[model samples]
Each structure stands twice: as C-alpha cells, then as structure tokens.
Target: MPASATKSLRVAVLADSDTRWKWGALTAQRLAPAGAGIRLDGYLLRGRATPTARQLQEVGVHADSLREVTGVEFLRAMTEESYDILVLALVGGGVQAMLHGLRHAWGTEKRPVVVTGYVGVVYEKLADGLLLRHGADLVLANSAHDADRFRAVYEGVGAEASAVTEVALPFLGGAPYEGEHDPSAEQGRRPYTVVFAAQPSVPDNRKDRAYLLDRLIGHARRHPEREVLLKLRSKPGEHTTHIEELPYQKLVQGQDPPANFRLVYGHMGEVLDRTDLLVTVSSTAALEALHRRVPTAVLTDLGVRELLGNHHFTGSGCLASWDQLDAGHRPVADEEWVARQGVAADGSYVTAFDAARARITELLDRPGPLPPLTPYYTPETAPGYLPGILARHHLGPDGAPLPGAPAADKAPGAVRQIVRRAARGAYRHGVQRVAPVIRRMGEL
Candidate 1:
C-alpha cells in the first residue's frame, strides 16, 4: 500500500528525562489507528531527543529542530499550530512550559482534546501546574493505588478519573511464557534462579534494596545453593550516598554465597535470561522480566534489618509501604489495579513496540465523547537550548539549560516532517490518516 500524508490525528507528547518517556512514546505509537490518520509530535523537554518529521518513517513521530529559528519563531509555531490531542507529561516545571505553548495556540484557535497523567503529590510538587488549573479534558491516574489514594486523601483529586484513566504503560504485552527457568534444564540444581535489579536511589530511599538484601542474605546463609542473584544498577556517586550497600560481591560457580546470595551490577538482561525469578520493589524492570515469563517478587526492607542498614523506600521495587516489609516487602501482581487504574481498564499489559502502534491507531481513529486512553509516559521534543528561555526573558543569557536548545526549540520543521512521513507510513500499512480539520492552516 502507498503511504498518505494526511496528518489527521495530531498528538503532542510532553517528555523530559523521566522514565515515563519510554512508556509514553511506546503508548502513542501503539495506540494510533492503522489508517486513522495520525500525526505524533514529541518534545524532549530537557533531553537530547527532538521530534522531527524526518524520523517519522517507522516511529511515526516528528522532531522539531529549532536550530535556526528565533525564540519568537518558536512561540509562533507553538501558538500557530493546532492539534487534535495534547498529552501533558514531564517533571518539575516542564508541564508549565508546555502549557505556555498550548495557551499560545488556544489564544488563536479553539482548543483540542487535552490529556494529562497525574503523578501523586508524594512524588513531587508539580501536581498543581498550569495544565490542571486550565483543566485537562482528561486526567490520568498512574496506578490504581494512586487513584484510590487520590480519592481517599483529597476527595476531588481523582474526581475526574471517570473522564480520565490510568493508562497502560510501555509493555504492551505478548504471548505468555511459563518462566525462563525450566526445572528440566538443570538436573541436580535448584528449580529457579531469581534475580533482582534496579538503579539505586538515595540511602534513605532504598529500603527495598536493604530489605531484599537482608532476606536474600539470610536465605543464602541458610541454604547456600539456591542460585539467587541480586543486582543493583549503580549510580555515579559514592556508596555512602546509597542505602545499605549490596553484598557478596560476585557469583561464582563453586563460591559459597551464604545460601543463595549473589549481588552484581549492570547486566540484568543476562541475569534474567537465566533466571526463574525476578524480584523488585517498584522497579519497572520487573516488567521486562515478566515479558519473558520470569516470576517477580517485590520486596521492601522493613524487617529485613538483619542484612542491611537504614530503611526507606526508593529504588524501583514495588515495596513502598511498611506493612509490605514483613510480608517480605512483596507486592502482588497488581493486575486488576494495573488494568483499571490507568487510562484504560486494560492498561496494565503494554510491552511490545508493534502492539502499541496498533493501539495508538485505534485511539486516534476514535472520536471524542469517549475519553482517550491515558498515556504511560511523557513524550519529549528536543530542546533547542537555553536560548528560548533567554529569549522569553529577552536576555540571550549564558546560563542555558542545554548546549543547543534555544535554537532547536523554535522551528516547526520537526512537526512538519512527522506530518508528512507518518501520513505516508500509515498509508503503506493499510491505514488512512483522518483529518478533523476544524480550521485550516491560516486561521491562526
């Protein structure tokens, strides 16, 4: 099939350095209809990525390159262009910045459907940004637990959830696996090799690591032959900065690791490839393990005090609460919560890149009245550099947020390419781009 260039569904993703970016990008691409005319725009916010039409070939997103335009030009494009849907994501003041763009557009034309995912206030103070004040057409609940908390605490925090959703994340899911460890594969050894991995956070915030370490250490001291692995993705700073440092150095075939204690860093994929279990607290990596059929255990350190020092909750483990500590800091699959909490009732199953594309197509094709599914992560466009910020202040100052943002953040070049290329790609896949064309190009 020949490709078309009809950017009917226009979507803008707001992403910064948050991990949610990965989930959000995957969601946008996968949810768009096959032929439902869609155009995706990405704003990197603080990172190196920029969405431009040039990259729309297979990915279907456009990066804007403001390499040459002035700050005024950037603002003009933001206000001048109209979209069908806008997904607000980002940390800190990023949502505020993007809202500036949306407000600019609203000043000139009728507003489009706006959707935003809400992270709890406990995570950060960005919950009351401009987007919320202006009112999002749709509000997103990141998790089911979050929704329940919202309702219980603030009363109205999740009040709009009926019009909102707890979106499914990047793991769009695939055929089920019985788990990577085959009891038949190893004769005289243990039935499963469990592995836990994550980037370590601050010591006070790494209770999951401490808890799991304590339990695994105790188990290892007692058993000594369980083939258990504990891997922590290291940080750039000192060990003292992290919580209860990991144990037992490396895993050797003949080496005694307590009973089952083994700790390492970096290569989680290799570890998961050979394990029957993947354990974590709230780390998303568990999803990676789950995709391959590895059973995962989420444990936070509360009572596992025998093996490590300090107790707090951070890392990626799902063990955020104290009650979970004695229960081995484990969290259930959170399946029903995962599904019903986010943007879609079926949100908890995203995994594959291809599957997400199919979902995105469907989402874009469907008209409003029915809420659009919530996005899992924030989408980012390139930051031209601090120039735009300077321009906004009319300073052209030296304290730029980036090396090249001022220039790259201005032009419409990035979105133009997405419009053209995504249209073509959709056409080839037997999908047609739909256009509401509420108002044509010059109306602004």
Candidate 2:
C-alpha cells in the first residue's frame, strides 16, 4: 500500500460511452490506495455514443454521484467544485479540449491530477490519439508493450514521456476457467458453450460482416451439442464506444439460425462464466477471456489486417480460423506472449496497478501548487489542428468558452430537457436507419 492509504480521495471521471465509462470507473477504484475512502463522481459526456440508462446499468459500476454534462458544462463544474483527481475517459479530441479548457478555468488555482488512456487495444490512430492526450499527468498504458510504444511515440516527437505509466486493464477480473473435464459429471454439467463476441465497427462493410455472421451460424449447425452464443455489445439503435454502420443484429435478421444458436446481451463477464471457447475478430473481450484462462481465438477468416485489429495478436498463438475451430482446434496461448500483453493469467493481476497507485499518491503529497497544464499542442505548435478540436467543445484558442457556447451555470428548463432527448432520439434514428438507406442508394 502507498503512504496515502490514510487519506480519503475525491475522484471525478468524465466518460463519453459505455465501454469508456466501465474502464474509467473501474480504473478509479483500482487506483485508490488500499483502505483509502474514495468519493467517485461520474460525468457522462453527452454525444452520439453517450450511453443510455440500460447501457449504464449493464456496466454495473456505481459512483457517489453521476450526471450527464456537455464538455463546457463539465469544465464549469470543475471550477465550482474540487477533486483530488480527474480521469478523462473520452476520445482524443475530448481529452485535448478538456485539458485546454481546464488549464484556462483553473488559472493558478490548485487543480486535480488528470489521467487518461485507451479503454482497450491501442491498435488505431497511434500518434494522433496519443498526442491529443499528451498533456495529461499520467497517460496510462494497459501493458508493458503499450508503455514502451507510448514512450517511443512521445520521445520521437520530442514531447515529455514521463507520463506513460504501465497498468493492466482495470475491468479484467472474473473467476478463472476450470478444467473442461467436469468432476461433477453429466448430472450437473452444462453443455460446451462457444461465445463469439461482436464489435461495433471492426469489419465495417456489409459483406465482411455478413460473412462472419454466416460462419457463426454454420458453426452452430455443425456443433449441435454445443451452445453457440452471439454476444452483442449493444441493441439495434443503440450506440457504443464506436459507431455501428452495419450491426450484426440487422445482418442476422434474414437467416434461420439453429435452435442451439442465440443472441445474448448483458455483461461480458457474465457471458464468460459459461464460455468454453471465446472467438472474435479483435474485440477486447478476447483479452478478458485470455486473462481468465479461457480458450480464446482471434479469427483470421477476414484476414489478419490492421483494420480488423487482429494484427495486434500476431505472436499470441491464439490466432486461428473458424474452419480450424470446427475441426476441434483450440489454440494454446503462449505464456511469454500473454505476459507481455498484460493478461496476468498467472495470478500477477493483483499487482498490475501498483505503479499507478504509487504515482498518484506521490503527486497528491506534493507541497505547493502544481504547474499549469501544458499540452504538447499549443496555438504555435498546432495552429490549424488544435483550434478545430477545441471548437467542437465550444472552447476558443485561449480555452475560454466561445460567445455562443451554452452557459454552464444555467440549468435547463423542463421543455429544454424534453427537446434535448427528442433531438438525441432523432440523431440515433438518422444513424441506425437513415444513414444506411442513403449508403445503399448511392451504391444502387
């Protein structure tokens, strides 16, 4: 435990989507020193992917206080209240905007230690995303491999690299998989279950998504005795961390699935409890399955491409095709490879966040006012790029709220709240229904 174990801490998390909320909330709990009382306040950033009530409930993490707020609104709240730490669980643009906004808002006043990082595999937008998140006090890396990559990116760009800290995925905790041979025998034994975790936008096109769906159905038909589950991240019309231009639910509509096959929704951890074989095309659920010692596979049916993110598992020894899986192929994970990925299947999971906790504690114990939040991209450094990012959050070049920006201190009336919900519903309708139709029309 760190020296700050005796101190109580107030932490605030600002997240945009369900996955990020899960990551940020769990991370806050893990970062707190053992035996320290923590007051967690959650701020859900309002946007296209902003989680619905159902999504929030599925995440199953409760904070002392939780509310929805716009980016500028959040900045105002920070000025009115105080917290020991702030976890920015947002996209690169959002993090960058908040860093600048908070810099101007706090202005010489003591500020919280800001932290941010990816929710899962850092397989896309390596430089763009990392640089946007550059100014954070700690840019958390979920693995030693990620820590090295993060440092290299920062040092290569001549930016400060001290902020990159190694930590494991905070959400990777569940009962380890027991042996396949059930000692309890047939009377109490459950059927072998195969779960295919679906991502929102990995195989973005209809053809690739349809092909994967067909394969899942075929697998179900072949293995009649096994329970085949399509574990969906969100329901139709609901958005997650990523946009789903082509949802599996929609693609599976015309097919006649076998009785043994089903679409399951809820927590991934709960689904993993019954999973004998976990399959995916680079969903982060693969990491969760690996951490629990479950037999896992990253499909090569669509090719090992960066777009699919399966390229990240090149040496994991868990990459295999569905055809091989149907022939009873179970890929054995390489232990050294697993360790490097921070899966912690060997009971090393308990100490994964020690460094993060120690660092937070040390920062809290600092004597006087900490220096201003200095981001890598200033007006002089990224004149063209930085302005657009801040404008999206209603912030100006100097981080002050723009003239037309909504006043944060003003509370919306009953009619305004109703209008806001209706607008969001209309926006989702456009994404899930209208946009696909337009795309199909263009192809025609």
Best of the candidates, TM-score: 2
| C-alpha-based local distance difference test score of model 2 | 0.93
Output the worst ten-in-a-row residue range by lDDT, candidate 2: 179-188
Instruction: Give the CA lDDT, 0 to 100, for residue 395 in model 1.
Output: 29
Candidate 1 lDDT over 310-418, as tens digits, reads 1212232333433333234333344443344332323234432233343333444455443322211122221453235334422232322233434444245778657
Quantify all predictions' global Cα lDDT against the true fold: 0.42, 0.93
Question: Which candidate comes out best when scored by lDDT?
Answer: 2
Cα distance off (Å), candidate 1, residue 353: 15
lDDT of 1: 0.42
Instruction: Rate residue 185 of model 1 by lDDT.
Output: 59
Candidate 2, which segments miss by more than 4 Å at Cα? 1-3, 181-187, 408-411
Q: TM-score of each candidate?
A: 0.51, 0.97
Q: Model 1 residue 91 lDDT?
A: 43
